[model samples]
Target: MIVPIPPGERTYRAQQAFEFAGSDLAGLVLFDDQLIQYFTGFIFIPTERPIALIITREGERILFVPRLEYEHALETAQVEEVRSYPEFPGEQHPLLFLSEHLQQLGLRRGLIGVDHDGYPPVMGYSGPALSELFAIRRVSAALDRQMALKSEPELSLIRESARWAGHAHRLLQQYTRPGLSESEVEARATREATQAMQAEMGPGFRSHNRWISGAVALYRGQIGPNSALPHAISINAVFKAGDNLVTGASAGVWGYLSELERTMFVGEPTPQQRHYFRHMLELQDLALEHMRPGRACADVDRVVRAYYEREGLLPYWRHHVGHSLGQRIHESPFLDIGEQAVLEPGMVFSIEPGLYVPGLGGFRHSDTVLITSRGAELLTHYPRELEALIIPA
Candidate 1:
């Protein structure tokens, strides 16, 4: 049996959600697969089939899932009350069950807090407007804020995922060679990393226990021109002497994730490539240097963006320094020009700064990090020095 989240912690999250939803809100409805997992610690790969969690301010919860998921829900959910529908396009609407459950809870009429973005597609949920039964208020932003702060358990999962990915990077470096294909190296690294984590974390250590393996995102290396495109999939580029390569990978331990990447040379780098590589490393350092508890997230991006602009290198810039990482991979409080949120302790982010010049190959490095009261704590530590990353051919 999976170790469940403490009942007190679950209650705390519900109380916090209610606080976010406001005391006037009679209840909160959760349909997003991730949010449901957050509350119940139950893992279910979302499909078109709908699943809902009806949670009231009084700390009452009724998990309504597809009948096929009933047994699984019973096995994983901490809540004693578990309910389900026959399936999609069932004889009875899913909302009808929700309404019945709500009525039983004596929440017949009042305001309801709901994640509008978490709702199933209208076509998938053709029931009467929940607004008809109760006044509806979109609390998606509130939910985002509530989930933004990393709990201790969440931090541990993320930190472990970082360690898992870091080990994968080591494996990828071992397999990387002048003749091996990008896919081959990535495959080897992913397999090795997955096995290592499974052995280390143990069978019962699963946080999300996803079928995609702990190295879900896997380690991928892009060579030469493909590397220059920033997000392009490797075209099976054969490693060649002096060719610049961007090796990046993410590990998924349970659902939490961490990113790790390094720009390397097959043998020796050209003066141009070496120059840009050093700049990329410096830019990453600048972002990390600026990460502190009270710093505005965008300021980090701005200071670095100014550096690129001053160097007349803004043309090669592609994206922000980094973004918040959690189970979702990409979350809010991004380190970009538009983000104004102040950094807080326990908020995790990726410090990925890149200079991708066409024809010159991409020079980028990324790492998972946590913001601390003093500064940012680096989690994905491998070697960053250009000389250290060279794959001797």
Candidate 2:
């Protein structure tokens, strides 16, 4: 069962949606089959087949679902009108039914904003075809751009999620040992996260997949030139006494998520591990120190790259400094050279700097951060300092 969003929250989301469409007279039509999996809330389930449609205009909202699910939609979703299609004859298909319904509602013309990219084509009416029939112009990139900025309520949800994820990480650290398999450590982390969410927000706020826990225990193995390469799943190897365990956990509450990653040494670390760990931490601090309003994301990247180049560790450092996080784990406003998006208040992103040495393993530290007027505020408060867990050999 999904929890109902407060009326005020719906109104806030609707306002943002209107701004995103770039018109005061815009409507958002989300087909039932759309993969709004990233959207936080229980009103809509993740579906590969379109079975629902949501239409929103200035001061008006409507939702259309199959007759059987009409009651559920009304109870869970926020909309002015909840309608079903069983009443219509000759058209069992939802798209055709919706088109006819829109015509009846006098919405057959003007600018209609359909989430073509967000919805599944098989279940919903194609934006172009609908435009041809209704003489409506489809708005592109408007909705996505609007969703990038986080509102107060949205930020609150994200902060809560991050808090739970931090607790999970602490539990994981306590349970980790030299002999523990990567899978075992990951399982414990997932359990910790699940318990945290249930304790804080209730069972309604649970993840659909194990991957949502986003807890990965990467044991020391071979490192490569590309630091991001170790971030891949296959690189998670066995644990040893002197190995560095790079682990992170991500938890989603309502539809918002916070991701955290850190490097932990098992027992005592070798000189090489200690050296690279300090270097990665330094790089992370540098990225954080450079973050501020009006600063180009690309400039932050350049500073990080310059530091690595000066230390002759450029090859090990690959990928961007970090990226935006919210409803989606990876959103827009990426921190890289090609990105020209200026830093703005209320914007949240991650700052992860890593060093990978081939045949030796990897070292990385990641935290979700929010860009404020004065500086960046770190959301994930787990320890990232160079420390060794004294596991009995």
Supply the TM-score for candidate 2: 0.82
Number of backbone clashes in candidate 2: 11
Would you list the C-alpha lDDT of every candidate in the order shown?
0.78, 0.65
Per-candidate clashes, comma-separated: 0, 11
Best-matching candidate per TM-score:
1
Residues 272-318, model 1: lDDT tens digits: 99889889988999898899998999899999999999888898999
Clashing residue pairs in candidate 1 (N, C-alpha, C atoms within 3 angstroms):
none
lDDT of 2 at 14: 63
Give the range of the ten consecutive residues with the poorest summed lDDT in model 1. 211-220
**Stretches of candidate 1 exceeding 4 Å from the true structure:** 1-7, 122-129, 207-212, 216-221
